[model samples]
Target: MNDSLIFATEGFGLNLNLFETNILNLAVVVFGLYKFLPNFLGSMLERRRSAILQDLKDAEDRLEDAAISLNQAKKDLASAEQKAGKIRNDCKERAEAIRLESEKRTVEEMARIKQGAASDLNLEAARVSGQLRREAARLAIEKALSSLSNSLDDKAQDKFLRQSIKNIGDI
Candidate 1:
């Protein structure tokens, strides 16, 4: 076994100089990458963090603005509801006033009509009374004239006519 190990070593001997050169090259590349890549990667990571923070701040500002708008809208809606209630109350009051005015006018008109009717009735009664009195006087005169013509004799009628003519001449 020792002879075979010596034969394998002779076939594949260690090249220390080549190994040292490859190790030195690898160290240089690792050191170079460490010196420059970290700065570039750190700057990129910092920019990404700043961008994310800026986006978060913008989102927060937008949320605040939305909240403010929502509060304003609520206040506006409350004012609108109050205004609507006031308007409704005003309309009811105006309607009531109109109804009262109409009722008052109607009552006044009814009273005036009643008064006019009473006046017309009184005037009609007075006219009818005057006509009745005139008719009664005419009927009384005709009745007296008929009774006197039937009761009086021709001699008495002549005497009455002569006396009436003498009395008329004297007047």
Candidate 2:
């Protein structure tokens, strides 16, 4: 009976010592975590802040580039419009000049044809007048010969006819 009591008391003392050792180990681990936690958390927060700042700078650069491109596009559009206007004006002027030239040529051609027609009419009239003069002369000569033949006696006629023949031969 006395040996059993001593064994129980010895077991209780061992359990108390184990409990104290475990509590001390837990306090040491807590202190170590407290000492290192601030550095790890601060590094993580600074990395996140730097990444956000870089993204904002990139966005601003993109916006500026877009504005510059927009301005360049507007300038190109204005230049293209000016060139189109000039081309249209040149075409209109050329068309007008062509029309005027065509009109002038048509007028000149009409005048040339009229002058040619007038010259042809004058030549035809002169030819007709000359033909009429020749016909009248031949008729007058035939009538004069018939009248002279009827009026002259046979002996006078013979003498006049010989003299007329000699004059015709001389002519």
Q: Best by lDDT, which number? A: 1
Report the number of clashing residue pairs per model. 0, 0
TM-scores, all models, native as reference? 0.65, 0.57
**Residues 1-171 of candidate 2: C-alpha lDDT, one tens digit per residue:** 333243456356333453545967887888877887778887898899999999999999999999999999999999999999999999999999999999999999999999999989888889998898889888887898888788888998899989999999999
In TM-score terms, candidate 2 sits at: 0.57
lDDT of each: 0.88, 0.85
Candidate 1's TM-score reads 0.65
lDDT of 1 at 40: 91
Candidate 2 clash total? Answer: 0
Q: Give candidate 2's error at residue 135 in angstroms.
A: 2.9
Error of 2 at 60 (Å): 3.0
